[model samples]
Target: MQVLPKGVRHIPGFLDRTRQEQLVEAIRLVVAEAPLFVPEMPKTGKPMSVRMTNCGSLGWVTDRDRGYRYQAQHPVTGHPWPAMPDVLLEIWNAVSASNKTPEACLVNFYSEEARMGLHQDRDERDLETAVVSISLGDSCLFRVGGNTRGGQTMSFRLESGDVVVLGGEGRLAFHGVDRIYPNTSTLLKHGGRVNLTLRRVNP
Candidate 1:
């Protein structure tokens, strides 16, 4: 078994098949209210491979002009983000190990060819709060490294229903998705992966 960094907890099969299906339905409602939009890299305006949206009080967004930041309204819809689902709140309460509630649930959908570069989630005001990531649908090669860029890294498969928590020393870890394994699972009707990241944006 590969050992993860300090404070980085990986729980395999955290959610059962039924729960995963329920969460997918909940996310469908969220996407209906706040459609998934393409996120762009700062300055270069390069589009990311994943399509994203969010729920909760604040949503994370990035663009060539504004860069990475949290906002209350969707960039495309210009409406307040939908409320965080109770199912997500229950999961956070169960595994977050924090007293405070999460204020943003960033939803990312990865196609078979989608890939994410190693990056840190540092735009939020509260760095101490842990980031909870829940995976559904297909599995993917998830990579993680130390806090510093260009450091040694490790890779592992994050299958559907797996959960990862980045807190304490590992909260600022550099992590990303290497690639998606096509037709890995049947959880999603279309055979893509959906990653839900729960975070506390403010202190």
Candidate 2:
């Protein structure tokens, strides 16, 4: 495991595949209640290509007409969002040194061709809080740039069971997955990479 100059952590094989699968199933159950749906972009309310869903106090939503905001219930089910599973919480507390408690888990699924452009995660209420991300399935080229953006960016080839902690100064840094490399792992059920971003929302 190594810490990037930007302060992002790259812990290799942090979660074993078996534990990773269990965590995935637990997260899937929450998603099953809500399922993955594309969020609409704020202001214009355009739908984002990346399907997103959450488990916790609020779920992230976006539509060309609505935009980014956390809602107490699922837009589709009208049911209160589910809690973040135990396995996820264990992992979060373990790595974050028990200093942070996560209330929202945003699961992002990427196919071989799917990719996220450079962006900063500023939707949460507190900048002091940390964002703990777990990666599974195929490997991906994850990139982290300077907080102000438009500078030399560092990238990592993240694979299954990798845990990355984004916090401190890097908490507000611009970052995203460049592209997923296919056939990187046979352990993943189907294909693609699944990123579980666990965050503490309440300030």
On lDDT, the leading prediction is: 1
RMSD each, Å: 0.7, 2.1
Ten contiguous residues minimizing lDDT sum, candidate 1: 1-10
Task: Give the alpha-carbon lDDT of every model.
Answer: 0.96, 0.81
- The segments of candidate 2 whose C-alpha lies over 4 angstroms from its true place after superposition are 1-3
Please provide, for model 1 over 43-116, each residue's C-alpha lDDT reduced to its tens digit, 9 standing for 90 to 100.
Answer: 99999999999999999999999999999999999999999999999999999899999999999999999999
| lDDT of candidate 2 over 1-203, digit per residue (tens) | 54474667778999887898798788678878878877766677665556777887776666666666677888777888888788988989887654767878888888888888898888888667878889988999999877877877878899899998887777887889888999898766788788988887778
